[model samples]
Target: MSEKRPVFPEFDPDEVSSNPSDNRSFGDVVATRLSRRAALAGGTAAAAAFVMAGGSAQAAPRRGPAAGEEPAAAPAAESGRHGLLGFRQVETHDRDELVVPEGYRVQVLIPWGTPIQPDGPRWLKDASNSAADQEQQVGMHHDGMHYFPLGRGHRGGDRHGKGNERGLLVLNHEYIDQQILFPDGDEEMTGEKVDKALAAQGVSIVEVARGKDGQWRRVKSRYARKVHGNTPVTFSGPVTEKHPALQAGNRPMGTLNNCSMGVTPWGTYLACEENFNSYFGTEDPDWEPDTLQKRYGVDNVGFGYNWHTASERWDVAANPGEVNRFGWITEIDPKDPRQTPVKRTALGRFKREGCMVTEARGRFVGYSGDDQDGDYVYKFVGDRPWREHRRAGRSPLDHGRLHVARYNDDGSGDWLPLVHGEGELTTENGWKDQADVLIRTREAADAVGATRMDRPEWLAVNPKNKDVYVSLTNGSGWDSAATPRDPNPYGHIVRWREKGGDNTATSFHWDIFVLAGDPAYDEEVKLGDNLFGSPDGLWFDADGRLWIQTDVSNSSQNLPEKGYDNIGNNAMLAADPRTREIRRFLVGPRGAEITGVITTPDQRTMFVNVQHPGEATEAWGEPTPQNPRDVSNWPDFDPEGRPRSATLVITREDGGRIGA
Candidate 1:
């Protein structure tokens, strides 16, 4: 049978178009492509060699004894040397269960439909839970997440606490599967069906505790809360005044398509609203769509959620302004469950993958990706420096300066401010004010000539060096007659050092850290045993080891026709930035995306989320106890069992630090 492809969110025109001339309209030659495919296909060997050597340093010379001399013995793990040296790389697998390194063990922590509230309805085997039950229980399709310790004050626990035993796990539920979410498949749109779907898409904050034996489990606590798509939210920033639809007294209810996330210095969570334009319909006559809406692909035929059938708020034609409420970074306070999530407007509206916050020169700075091919990278600088005592009051994200990135062919880049009065972003260019510049960020970026990237997914800041790393996922359609850009069929990771080694700097130097692809496809750049593609879900541990996760499509996994076929399945990898050595750490189940990774402050226990397992399966015929048609029944590989997305806790068998 043919593999069923998953329907992802809509892509911007620039992301899918083949005309390279379209990129020329922005007034600059596209930055040189650093992808391995472009390198092998016919770029200069010197350039390819530079990329293989990690772009920053040349390959180290062999330090061992000569052929006639004896080689020295390797050092022990307990020695002063730190980081991922003790753990062996795990081979890629295409099984239906989570796979980890030999010494590491994985346990299923929290699965979707698990009840968070004491009185919430329990998960039924047949998947017959009600909309109210879903709202009270854990939502579906877990994505990005963070762990906040319970008794360590608002600052969280120390990195070497006694196991860092307890904390609140805040995770995002990206989307839902109608066939699996509803007991009876959703063949028709009903208020009940729509409600259940809505209840399954926002964020979940659950309290989890680790026992004396090192096992972790979710427990009922006052802090447990569910912020779904129907919850009420307030809009902040310049958008409220710039868009009449978001004016006073027009509070938007809930957030949809929450993809990736970030934690603020004040300890709040920032859940990104990605692909939100697909949730609303454009049939209302009163709604007049603008160029921005058209560019985002907002149209009459919705993503099939059909929320408009039961609620007018989902009808953009009737309430055109409502669309403006989404696409902004949402701030949620997990400690205070009753607090309403706030839409932070200062970050600028876009299909954000998420934002990563770090302190630089006493100020708070955030980096985020638009998550579409040909889109620009952005950064927001808070107006004031972060104060330890200010955690009780206002959010630092309320006021900030947003900037887009412009990369030079020589490995230098600058952050062009999105301020209205700035160059190219003036009245003559159709930017009326700061709000207008932010509301139409893509257009403003085009005007300023920001560099176009291939589906920037996640941003991570190295704890040791403060350098920033971004995952540029795979893309195609670069071969055009007018102009030709690199067709990065496989993904790669890009790292940049901020000018003067400061996170707030507007200028920086960058290099291709690692070109991801099958080793067989690229001989010169291949880092044996570490070859992987479509880099996504990046984070750095306290020890500064970068963890990279893969998100290969179902049709591409194990297919000989694809470049990544040799890399069994979507997996996670660890890399030491100093040496540029990337090693595979774990491989996730088939047809699932490995995402949402976080470890305890003690660095002993780690949590990783597996999203949408069995996504490639066809849901047809009547449901029965004998057989539940599934392409992959992960977590519980029972033939008749229904596949559910879940979280896995990984620990070392020797009771030592993870990845040691």
Candidate 2:
């Protein structure tokens, strides 16, 4: 009876158990029963040499194609195809919708309560709208996006002009389920349902265009805004003057759980504030907590979005600095919807999951990822260099030089420098300066030793070889006394290059570009046509073609006794990193989660994002009348409705581009 544990042992509610035949949310039966108890305590040739060098060969990727060959034909569409060239890889689907490929099409454009301003509020089928009509509509789960473009003039578009054909999408509304946004689910969590779930959590922007029949719609413009969770925003760098709970005249309100985003090459829009400590709670006792709130698992049982009964700044003992103004990196300026969103804070808050940026030799680097489970890997750079004009109101993420990575078991790494008086970041290692080394950036990267990883989330880069990648997305409680390596439990993709290929290089070299699981669990490092697992959203595009989404675990799709049944759903592969192939492009819709991809710089549109579909059955909350179904209605399954969370688009029916 002595094995109870879990008071949030870093959340293992049976791994996101809203239950769906519970395969222990991505732990695939606790990593196949800890690989059969480490092959009976270190035998079976030491657990097959630690699962083939924990996913073979310093994590494969010295150029593609080899793991089961076949990748070769992709040079046609006007002799300029990109990524996984000549395309033609698409077979896994538990189908509820979206599949893509064969000339591509997809559609859907917007979903989660779409309205796009102009006095919003009109999406109902029981979403009962109104937190002022979801702060004038369109917000809820549609994670990470970007598109800016407008009249082909500027703002990350105009690959050949008129192609982006008008934009300003922006996205990221990350959370809110309340049994699909209330109608009395869990008795509608109170008061205008927590003010329409805090106006359906942050960031939206809208404004899409294209139609003369070419598709892409959502137009209403006035820079169609949304930025919820109470919107005010401000803070800029050095934890807004050394965190006394982030000072600078106290501005920091909105932006929540935004997840995977980053645009700026002098165009703004970064979002990312993942899992905002699950919308905080813990009633005041004079709050205290610390150790960066227990290494960011922050408890007091909150993700129930009780929102401290509708605000006491959602409690943390009544505003213990509003969870330090939500894990930083906010930014937004999708062509100014009356500008305001700032955060930035020298880019160093954990739980961040996205932020890519890139400019290299002229500074402006970026690249984050601290999405839990043994966290680490970060970047930043930019003290000043990226001048394509923006001095009339500065903000290259306010000022940088963050760092953090470490790796080194030889394949090389090293970045460190979270600089607070440097070296052991000290006041004898208490780090009391650069905003306490950027608000205790994971205890100053575990006081300079770094390298914990195995759940880092996005970070793409590689516009034709700037090389950066990183996804890692699956970790499930390892530490049966350390030493397992490579981002254990079915998840990989590391990549690196830095140094001379400078992104302000502190040092680099890294490897491991694909070791996701179940191609019969590593037949020499899987992938012979996409046998994916975990690898959460990494992008690339503009003709570099890396893509790769995943997130698998709708009870391990198609469930082959919970072991990644030959990669059946939750997909969107694409790779090519110079012929290290990896195909299967697009395959979600059964329990969703094929998160945000993005394209259109005339790569002929693309988009992606699926997130939480039929979230493991049990027909979501509320909706009675003899169980009026609501778990997987999806894009319009409407068995009484409720399973939104969309944003697709795709294109190429004959227009070209898009993984041609």
Candidate 3:
């Protein structure tokens, strides 16, 4: 269908041959979002005008702040309402250290292998930590996270009071770096190696607070704990009837590849299971995946994890049903470890990314995306409101309707319900009931003609106007008019306003918020100074500042030929919703992707994660012990040190609001 292209074996593209072609692309809506004539002009005023219009030409004006919510935390002199950025913008660079604007400082906290408890095993620089030790230590590749104030009850934006000085930080460990994990450098597989790798993923809940010196430190509280691949998980929602595919002994063994996350109004943490299929493989050399398994990406040989070699738990040939128990949205209560982690099946599953929940008409409405190219975005609408559901001793998450999004060529979209008897989701299509529909959510969305997105990664809701935003992490197809480059390496973010400003509305209007790329490579650069690619994680602070995190693949971070050399390292930027004004706030170390971000209630202390530093062990050259030059060895500057993923706490020298 097109000209010859470079071969990338690891590239995950939209592979469904039967899927409808998506030509609406950035060319269609982006030009309309700015009026083709205005977009080609590339003038700052038109960009600001589009942003001030709340992303969509048909969208209503921005709504006022929610009740009891804090006031907008920032406003610099001469910036107008949202014009002036509070912090100096940091330039993109390839330094081996984390950098922030002047007058602000960064302190590395809780690096990987740090003991969860003070009495636990300390990290050994020689990579000799046992599998058991990993269970009690910080996990690898820190991602989406949140800060809950200590000594208080969290309820739907209520922190019980103004206690942000101390809190519990809950984060996700996406995956492991096998190259650095084993001292021998990816030697033959073993049960112990699999155990250690599995134990380093899932979620980490650790108590941390600022000391008298204003430095944050991890606290050894009773609440500090780790939930990993060995942790027992329970099921809830429409698919809790002990389906055969979900048979993993009496209970499911664990959650794998925990990526981005979300939080419920009642304060429970939602850990998204992304790339869960990589943990499964078949012992049978000639094994093949069934239709359902194929759609979910189950294969005979998994991206080299090789867990099946040592553990039947991951051997799909031995226990094929076990693979179905994963790919779910796991809920963990950080305050009480006694409560079991619940996989909310009502949300449906297909390599779940981030689940951002908002209160829609006293009930819960959750938004999530299936983080793969040509996948779909979904939302769950609860039937019962919060107060009534809680009084009746029910979880709002356990009773809801999940629907996939369908975008039109115009600037509008629809949420088509995935019910058992609805449309093609009937018994004739292999969907016996709602359980089957959710187990194979992707195909159901496909059956209903859902719009295939680039690589929907994360979703965030605005605090000021309740609008929604999603970061599409590039694609192998779908050419964009905003950029002239081929292959569209850098993705863009989209914003939408529900019909009549109601989050529960089944229809909405959308527009392209921004397209990210470096013009030097013949691709158009939309957001200057805040230039970035591969937008992965997103969050909106109390003051309505949209925080964006980049996830440039480690393989291309330093390669100029891949079109990312101009956008060095990864970075975190802050954007004002009212204007297209965006400023880079932080830049991570070489080879690392800046991910997972949050700040205190007062917006004073901010936490950002530096993940996978010193990645891609040399592609332009070969490596040897005498000249083994890794991309970077951050935090630990010793020549013999290993790069470790960690969280950093940033605060102003004057203790003022963050992004100020």
Candidate 4:
């Protein structure tokens, strides 16, 4: 469903710009290919590495040396690699491996097979983990993560570590590789693989403390928890009580595909669920015109892996009616591991890729990306101002107005209302009404006319400028010759400054911050346009340095030979937003995507996740004889040797703050 431009609230394009080429600050002509097939194809290419991991795990050689064989190094301190710039790029590769500047060390905090629950089953190479046991262990495909200092606040007896303030590392288990994550493939997934897979797809909260030698270890604390498919969720907001699809005769269920996360102003964590719609396969799977089904991508019975064939199918195990629960932004209070997660249904559900908060007029404004081809961008305006009190009793998310954006042909834009009981969304237009608007929001946005964009993925707010930046993934409609307009072809990064210094305002001035792509592509693609292409995850460090991570997995054509061909794997770059200058900082291993970045408050430690390495191969048992040429045995198997999808710690050799 697409949103139509509403007549009530009028916007002036001329006031936003004067010259055609310079009218809109965003580069509309710098287009990327956008197609349903393209999106799926991209997933297939990226998912291949994970498939191989499964195949090799089952048939490969035995496990090697036990844990802790490597000696612990001194706590991170000043070293030559740390230099004046402060950050030194240590490891770089297209294959899956962890990298750190010299003088800094890297270690695996937790492995995919680690036992998290008291009774969680030990993971075996042949794929024998059970659903019930998995509920107690850590999930798979770890992505965005954040570390929080605990003990300073929390309930009684639950005070974590003492003087040192032992902390919690919250990770997002993005998705599962049915092949490697399981024993054989879906063919061998059996009862255990399905259950474990579901259990591994949510959030993993583990306690971490600096060991006796200054290394970090997962501390055995009551605060450690896992929220997955079976975990209960609370539905609160406009659509909670009335939306036809989500009503469930009661409330929503769990969260799936928790790709990226956000830290709220009040200190709670916001986990965004992406690709939730793909899990919902209906009873009458043949129903083509189903409204709820169409809006949420639930038309097919089984698109690839027939998860329904398994015992604990979320769509069927807890009432097919309950699948409506997965897409919204769910908030988790790390301090209290036992409390239920809240699905802020007010923020219309789609494939929520990223969620972020910025202070505006004292109130907190939440920004998010729907992560679908041509989907709209959204922001939530909280009713109350954010208080600095970090005590354990408050949650600032209760009330807010959710608005969808309409980017104009010119640089400026307006926020269209997706509120209940307002404008054409009422019960008058043969519609099921406002509740429907909140549940099947894409449809409601279409009825109102919000501008369709290239796949909207990650969002970043520049701490120095208060300007918002969004990574627009690759699009098919972005062809420069096909569209004539400077539509984002290879996808670009867009930015906007709130009007009159108010983020909660209904309108704002905007521009194309960086037209992501090869400078050799086209002069028009150049946007006076700063440099870059296919921008993905974005974050601003404490020192006002903006880190731009590229999602160029599909556009390898743009990269030059020599240093790039053998070493490039969707890198994380740093840019001075003030000067629009960007430099590549870190790269990922083969078949792996770099994600989930964070730096310690003092900037001494930088943590990052290398996801799904050595992706393109078949089952572990099938000998290389059949599929003669496939990349397998990732991170650890590389001729260079390493493990797939592991979190790494990066620190400056000189021991100053990162990016100095």
Candidate 5:
């Protein structure tokens, strides 16, 4: 990929808050990941290393927690009465007023609409946010986030071990829901609303300090910054220069719908652009559907957002070509706010939902999901070996070939390359060439028989086993069958092992790790003993404990007897993958989907987001008890109240590791 095609928010240090270094060690870890910049320059070295290590079939099977490496077990109260199935919620009466269990407390460090820049407009109810100013505000709908402690000044190591005082916090500001964002409607948003909403859609780079009082607060720091939608981002790797997607404007601008995020082994943050397709409008009405577009996703919608009617006419003003700029994995260096983020197009673009980086045979492997009906799962293999450049302070992310997965009838698969000039992709029945194929990757994946999946959302690699975990929602014809069977309808957590025992291999084996259902009675629908419903947000603790979160939208109406009938909303589950045992750990307030889980290094503090609590607008009210004046006041202070989307932090009643 080439860096010439810039398409992200520009770098602006003046827009950041100036705070002193409190967590230096944590920053060092992040800096180390960003510094190792050249190992990814060559692809053959990484490919060979995987082959030399012997393929997947012969490698040592992953092991679970060893005898003494585990933290002391959490007490019964924290673990819940149902043994492994219990989650104690935290209590708080902040802006987001949702309920948590006893003995827990949640702090709203940065709520939705919180300003990121110093002089940014305060998020008001009337919608005064603008695009020019959006560059200085916090992005909306915060989703997947990770808290990394800064390393000791420049000493390169785990800051948590050295009792470091300061650290850099990288959080993702996901999609901006137009309904609640703009005062009237998306079409009603004016200058300010548009700007504010755009600014709130990217990532926030801030500094945090653990006060002597034992609480974490946003440090009054210089590093507090917001990377808005219009930031200048460089394009790099694989499909960068040749694709029509990149051809949109010589350079694309802004990243929209950033959802599930990934932290590289090297340290920089990977912010994925999900649901970006909804932002673009087709200028070429005669735009014949490419075979690749038809296969991957792009064929359905014609006219997109009529930005002229809303705030900041990104569609009409800035660059109408701007829509194509989105939908790539953007890499950001949190340590140095001055660095420009890069859109790694080699990863393939389409409603990209998540990025999970893992290592096999000393190579870097990345797994991403396209969050659309019947989309395909894709992975990238770096060209060079993933050496301990981080130990030496460097970033190894430049070279890699993008490939899509195909689940064969025999239950095996191949990682078909989407590169423009080479592989089986070049000699196909359709595409002009490899570059043509990369531009329409979804279509190309279909050309190769890649298994279509239900809207694939978040993805997390199992820490202990090194298996890739993917969340598959409803399936569209392009990715899977419309009915519930092998891979559609009732989505499951799909896991796969790289074929060459290396992260960069072109083949792998896969299976449904866990299926979602109501285990209490729906045996036919539930694949596992601990049956649940629609699995969405997913994360793995340092100990490799797989935390599965749910996103059941319609509530009681969707699941009548699945135990979700008029009760607790979407819940979070902690499962031991090795044993295939899953237990509901925590549930959110009414009408909210549980998302974005991140833990401190010690695993003591867990942060989760409750998105759109009072989603059912009709459920909200005028003078009735059901209809609260403002849905913003949630996690309800009054037990019998409306719901709101807020961030919830959870920890043990005994100050121990969360899932220990």
Candidate 6:
């Protein structure tokens, strides 16, 4: 066990920086280099397209087939390529194991508690499930997801493979771990352990299927559902119904701290809402909390989900309008479970993590980030062409516009425009219209002068070129020539293009794509054995590769005195964005965190997700069954098991295509 304390909480997002006057805000100064094995020992092909992506060394740009597009050599990478990351990488190993690569073939699928309702009830070890049986099982940790096939075609469904043989995965249960969901693991606060930890925080879907022996199972359909955190959501654009600083109530509920996710070309399922100011609290010793709940970190012991000292609707001073209906962006419709799950709120709210979506200029944008640290970076767009506001039923994320992102150090940027009465929002700066600026979307993105990044987690796009990438994940003093890092402690990845490739271009141009640490504390990460660091989940694969994932928490993974123990656990790489190459394709287990990845539409069944594997075992405060998990019991090693997070599925034992 790596004896490092701080095992997450204090409403983590590696947090701290509610903008203490210019939390440094990218003034510029990042030009380091020489690692990735000293830039691959000076090899050629433009030094193998160099770009270790940190403070720009540049060289790696080839990109082909666009104007009149036609480059179809699909047995995997050929169109403009350095073999577009074709497998065989997997290295760093602290193995409590789910390693992958070597003809990959994983398969765990749906873990936390399983049972997608068929009168629920499966999973039960010593950890006795139940907050209504963890809301019909399955919900705990797994983050950012998407699959959806079930009788296909809404845009790349069945991906040319039998409507993906029945689908509907969905995912995102980003919370709950009261030491493996209670059984007196860390007992005491009740309301039935805060209703089984807000019934294991929101979003699930389930309905999988592939079984004709190709393996994928779990289909007790009625299109399986979950959505809880106090479910009963509803609300949409322009802050839903006249915002007077949003005093909303009348049964407004939502998608909870469900992290990393997005998907909707009308297929639905976005579920963002990171750290919802940790499930609120206040046993009122004179309850305080203003300055937008301390600029949205809200404390009084949350993150340890004391759900308001055992639930009074998570007492923010007795339901302060139930924490203004939770940090927005819900939108589920996993093939209709009677719809209901909207939120949207013009996609502004802070704590939102991933959103992605493309198709610019003719509208339908969407790009989101707001994951804290010096927060900001958003998009939105759509005032049309989301099938023209879903054929008049409205809600292309409530008739678009949002914006906010500034960057500039010469690499140019500016999307700015959180709009209210324009510039610095009006009504003497506290705007009163656009529903109080979409209910204080970070004080209307701190009234205009945006660019405060370094926490912008999950965002990816590349419908063959309008680019976009993201995953700032950590931060320090901020230098901003695209994440120049200060004390960043590994964590990078940024990319952009959008201007002429206009994803509704409000102007753009960026760099630094992949610098997630360790070339001996990163001289722009020189990938020796493909060492990795905090780049938290991204995705691209339709063969443009990208992929990446890693969270490194649990007091910074194996801690080599904090240089991140040779970067082992928490992995999942595969870059090659025009050959800046990156490799290691899967490594998660001890203390797991390689999260939500997707595939299948003939991308041959990938899936991923691991999450909270051993809950950072220092004997996880009494995780019994003869002290279950000192590191991991992953995908069930059942000695009365107790480490689960699960949903791997992998496959490629010749079925080909995953990461091809």
lDDT of 6 by residue, 1-660 (tens): 123412222224437767544422642412222212221222122123223222233333432233344322112212334466667776787778877778878888788888886568888877777688888888888888888766645246345556676778889888877866787755577887777777777888888777778888787888897888767777777776334454544466657778887887777888888778777788788988887777777766667667677667777876776677778888888878887888888777878887888776556788988877788779988766788767778777888788888776545577988878888788886577776677678867776767777678888886555578888767663654445545576667777665556687787656565556666654434466677887878888776778888886666677666677788677888877665667788888788788888887777788888888887532223244356666677777887768888788888888878877
lDDT of 3 at 265: 85
Q: Report every candidate's CA lDDT.
A: 0.72, 0.67, 0.75, 0.58, 0.55, 0.71
Q: Could you tell me every candidate's TM-score relative to the true structure?
A: 0.86, 0.33, 0.89, 0.76, 0.75, 0.35
Task: Compose the digit string of candidate 5's lDDT tens values, residues 510-618.
Answer: 4445445543333333323334566888888877678888775442313433233322356777776554445556655545667888876667677787776545422
- Cα lDDT of model 2 by residue, 225-298, tens digit: 78887788777766663457654233567888787888877688888887777777865565666667766667
Question: What is the Å distance of residue 334 in model 3 from its true position?
Answer: 0.5
How does residue 43 of candidate 1 score in lDDT?
28
Rank by TM-score (best first):
3, 1, 4, 5, 6, 2
Candidate 4 has an lDDT of 0.58
The deviation in Å at residue 249 for candidate 1 is 11
Q: Which structure among the candidates has the greatest lDDT?
A: 3
Q: How displaced is residue 31 in candidate 4, in Å?
A: 10
Candidate 4 lDDT by residue in tens digits, 159-190? 23332335677888888666566544566435
| Candidate 2, residue 9: how far the Cα is off, in Å | 46
Clashing pairs in 6: 35-38, 35-526, 36-526, 36-527, 150-167, 361-504
How many clashes show up per model?
1, 11, 1, 55, 67, 6
Model 3, global lDDT: 0.75
Per-residue lDDT for 127-201 in model 1, tens only?
Answer: 788888888888899999999987753344455454388889999998887777877766676788888898888
Global Cα RMSD, each model: 6.2, 24.1, 6.1, 14.2, 13.1, 23.0
